[model samples]
Target: MIAERLSLQLPHTKVDPRILSALVCGSALALLALKWTRQRRLQQKLEEARRKREHALMEMRTMSLQFKEQNPSVQLEAILSLPLTELVEKLREGSLSPESVLYTYMGKALEVTHEVNCLTDFLPECVAQLQDLKKQKQRGPLYSVPISIKEHYDYKGHNSSCGLAYFLGTLAQEDSVVVQVLKKQGAIPFVKTNVPQSMFNFDCSNPIFGQTLNPHNHKKTPGGSSGGEGALIGGGGAILGFGSDIAGSIRVPSSFCGICGIKPTEGRLSLCGISSPVYGIKSVHPAIGPMARDVDSLALCMKALLCDHMFHLDPTVPPIPFRDEVYCSTEPLRIGYYDTDGFTLLPPCMKRAVQETKKLLEKAGHTLIPFNPLRMEYVVGELFLKGLFPEGASALLEKFEGDLIDPNLKPQLSVYKLPQLLKRILAFFLRPVVPRIAGELKALCGIGSAKNLWKQHAAAEVYCQEFIAEWKKLRLDVVLCPVMGPAFNLGYLGKLVASGTYTVLYNILNFPAGVVPVTNVTEKDEEELRHYKGHYNDHWDKLIKKAAAGGVGLPVGVQCVALPWQEELCLRFMKEVETLTREKSRSTIGPRIEAL
Candidate 1:
């Protein structure tokens, strides 16, 4: 007040206007200089982080290669070639030593890591732990069995960076709940795999760890946010690996990489200590589960995790043990299936993959009924997208406050960066011109207010209940549907952002969904897809067709969905699909795993 009064009073005796102008200009320049210095300092810190990350990465990569090089032709085949189920059985029967299993998988995983940049942290501590476990007289189910983990699983002393440069330096003080359960059951977690920056995008890439590519074909993405685990398991390096799914993080990778993944309903497996960007926002809670080469492997890993040990570790998880009866049931089921998700149309390969599976299920004596895709425009546009960013994406954006952004996240950020006024204008104008992209952009804008966010939350529950009621009305036991497919070529995610509607729907519904590979993309499927127009013939369909082009021999997969908490039944259905796929392939009845 005194300063204001003095300035106003002194206005009658003002200094030279030129001098005042110069002073004002000087102040502005100083502020700019201050900002410039802060940015420079930030750049220096980032440079230091880069050097440290590069050094550690090179050392780890070299060490991984050395493990491969040091492997003698002795017993690595027995270690690497056996499926996870067989590996565990053999280990239980004393067919393999703990050290040998660790060494063999370590060597093979390192080889895959070198090719795909998958493993985020190679834990030598795993070896020490294994050696210690070897002395125990009593063994657990996963005794001497090697398992891989998604990078988000915290292991004491290692950072769960999840591809973010900012999270690179902070070390975890304790193991995550999943890690504890795995260790208690005697599973050796030797390596943690890479994920997208912030674990948000479907393509796994970051400045710290780079991108993870498909092991089957290096030209295509492995699918993410669990891309590293998908790459590891798909490449035949890890027997069973753990990953988390919000949308299709686990299943998309499984579909893309020709593996199996299970997304148990929320609270089935504990997420305690698991690193996630959207940790507490639970409208679509991220569920942690297992990914593997086959359905049995998935079940085995799930059984190990969904035990009393897990409940003890995190009391939040319901004390529900794995249900053997549901998994072991042999009775035929009534299944509902669809080729397209209604939001994003399936390409020919994807449609064919589902069609083939539907036929196989029918032939296997399971009744198959056509299920229309539900209200995906609202499910995706209003419920899921709004639910995720209901707070206008502040939680999601805070991680990038001063960090280097990944190219994979660039397109998503564009939507997040748009002004509310601009979004409204675009929404109105694009509603008729390009409704699909408009809805997507509008969804990405996030819910602007708490009232709107609450509506979205209530809307999600209502939608889930409505979906369940529909399922009951139709008497559908399980749903077999096309997963978003063809293992997209790298750099196409920006255009194909909506391609994941197939997987995201289940997340919103909180369904227990598992993915299984049905067939590889054939020349015919690819050719047909090139000229393909989807059911709706919308903009998304056109974009999908473009993305699916040249995807020949890339794997196509179908998602097996059951009601929430029905993971065991979901796995059982996935097993049936796997069994029927094998039988059909043997009889030359339909699409084979290898199109060639």
Candidate 2:
């Protein structure tokens, strides 16, 4: 019976070689032509957008020159030197005209962008907006203050390209809720800054707008997707700007740029009209916040933005206004401090930033308690990496289909784009060699079923509860920790994304977090970094160690975190850190402080 069955097997069918060759060649040629067409189309879109931006900038420059020529008495240097508070005070008192301030910042922005390439579009409509503001009898909180916004915020008549060629010509029909509030508060949205492609990568670069160089060191990234705002603000082009954060988009850039920024609890501020590639990922909700040169500026921005206008425009946001009392309170409270998240070890500069911040806070009479982040490796994998792309990275990968990939986003994208089964097999084999990478690989495979996605979200909630229980057990008012860097080399994050573990923890917990610059990388810090090794003796760790070199004099900052809905308290902590850093800088007691 076996012999009969074997004998019954059909012979394999064969095709003519000539026909097969023709089919293969035809398919290959068609694919090449398709790819070439896409590239050409992308270039056309990119060139058109660049031309529009260039035209806008030229108009702005002409207006700026006319303003300077018209207002011969206006002191551009003095006006630019003023902080947000003083600037607003001058504007309110009629000492500084809105146009003068606007033109001053526009000129400064032009100068800064020449070096850093941080700006996307110069809003010439700001001149018209200034006229509108002049008609208002009463001054608003941010009256006549020029502000730059991250490019993804929807502004009527402008494209929120988000550094992608596909979105280059798609204009917003109306202003974002936040932009509406800014206009209502008398702030001039003079220019929009650049962002990473899809606004996902931490290193700011995209094919259309190019890369934003750090104002401090050209070789280092300014941090993204708020990197343009960071570079602009840090370079003193704009006093206060707005940037959104999911996983350190705001705070990391602020930290790297030696500035201040806050990521309020999700839903605390309106996110309506923000263009997002990950529009509906509820597992890790992105928050909109202010990035400024100082904590006070951030507070002022928050105060102005969290108004009835924002609440009315986006009812999904919590209606609670900014709490002045919480921000101004002088209460001495318990604070938790940690240098390492345990998943990825910080470079010496980052560790020193946290250590020095702890000492300064303790000296200021705030009680400091030691707190260790629990299961951070697990949180990073299951809660963050998995939660972000629960349906799998296919959707995100698709966003980059026809666009040129930023170098910094390519490594992670390559891994995420791998076949699900192949990823799992790779993860299993690398478990012993690079446990963290393996875990991330496994998590990135994603839960293919709805039931599994639900379970994963459930696991995230449980983890947050456990983490909060620990916080409650300690009775901590705030947690002080290192923000991710001393501005790594421009393309560093592409190789080692786990560096984001520091900030992703708070995002997972949905806690309010702020970053305040405390110190500059010291020579001693660089020496210590030479011997640095991460938890794994793997490629990622080696890359991190290599990227941390030559970081001396770069700005370092620490993060201050508070419980959900405690943005006011978080800002208060940031202010305290800023205050202490200033005093310490004056006395030269610790590592060199670089205060904004």
Note the residue pairs that clash in candidate 2.
none
The number of clashing residue pairs in each candidate reads 0, 0
Quality of model 1 by C-alpha lDDT: 0.83
Error of 1 at 474 (Å): 1.7
lDDT winner: 2
Tens digits of lDDT, candidate 1, 37-77: 87676577656655754565565556546655775544777
Q: For all the candidates, what are their Cα RMSDs to the real structure?
A: 3.0, 4.7
lDDT of each: 0.83, 0.88
Off by over 4 Å in 2: 1-31, 589-596
So what's the TM-score on candidate 2?
0.94
Query: For candidate 1, what is the TM-score?
Result: 0.92
* Poorly placed runs, candidate 1 (over 4 Å): 1-73, 535-539, 589-596
